[model samples]
Target: MNKKQETKYELILNAAFEQMKEKGFEKASISQIVKRAGVAQGTFYLYFDSKGAIVPAIAERILEEQLGLIKSEVKENDSIDRIIDVLIEQTFKLTDRNKEVIKFCYSGIAYYDSFQRWEDIYRPYYLWLEKKLEKAITTKEIAQRKSISHQAIFIIGLIEQSAENYFLTDEPKKDEELNLYKQDLYHFIKRAIS
Candidate 1:
């Protein structure tokens, strides 16, 4: 798309994101989005079919943004421990950057009955993690007691849970506390594999 079209699309999506955060996905409406965006109502339909369609777009954009960051950090030649650190660090970094979007995914959005759409955005990144686990298993960088796919799910779930815990708190604990939690988590995971 041309620059103008790209800009319009971004404007609409960003407005939608803000509305969704304030009113939630189920309550957020197209009219509100276009109004906030200062774009015509017709312009919304020019891009998205419905709020449900926008949901996937938000999820896809979120995943792509963070996955791009993560892809840069992981070393193809790095050991499993190093990769784990990279993965956890990238996960937390992205969580801090897009906490709203992350909360939306696990919040009322997940109950939308469009499970496939939610899964679509996550599948690519989850598959990438699975591939990494598979490679580590094959290279003996990590243990092979379980299937790499299962291990990937474990890693993804752990990251999500940890991040949710971190973001859900109000006081915002210190960096040292978070680091110690991560270290403990890593050792627990290592024990399972070792």
Candidate 2:
């Protein structure tokens, strides 16, 4: 796609994201998204088939963004413990910032038939974590595991679920509480992998 098309596509996506975050997936309409994007309604069809179709795309985009951020923050020579620290910190911040969008994506994908694409959307992030786990095992930073893939998935689940619970729950946690939670979570993951 050319620059103009790419720009329009992102505009539509951004508009949809905003709409979904503000009004939720069920209530957010295509027309509203197109209007917010400043594109014709037909243009939305050019990119996405329906509102539900955008869920996976949005999920893919968010995952890609998170993966990029995490990769940028982590260095090649960093120890596994340091890597876990960065992962937890960055994931928490991102989850807190995009809690609404994350919720919308989860609910939207859950209700739609596009839920099958969920694994595909997360595959890159999963593979990245798997690679890290493999390296940690090679370097003796973590215990040798029969299934590095499962370890990666478990680590991701631990970090993401903990972050969501801390940030998205009904009761808000203070900064000190977040610090304690992160410390406990870090040790738990460390012991599990060690």
> Could you tell me every candidate's TM-score relative to the true structure?
0.82, 0.94
Q: All candidates: CA RMSD in angstroms?
A: 2.7, 1.3
What lDDT tens digits, residue by residue, belong to model 1 across residues 1-194?
Answer: 89998898999989988898788776888999999999999989989877666776777787788788888888787777777777788778778877776666555355555677777777888899888777778888777765776777788778767876886668769878888988887787666655
Off by over 4 Å in 1: 1-7, 21-28
Model 1: number of backbone collisions: 0
RMSD of 1: 2.7
* Each prediction's number of clashing residue pairs: 0, 0
The most accurate candidate by lDDT is 2
lDDT of 2 by residue, 96-142 (tens): 88898989888888867775699878778889888888899999988
Look at candidate 1 and tell me the lDDT of residue 83. 72
Residue 6, candidate 1: Cα error in Å is: 5.0
lDDT (0 to 1) per candidate: 0.78, 0.90
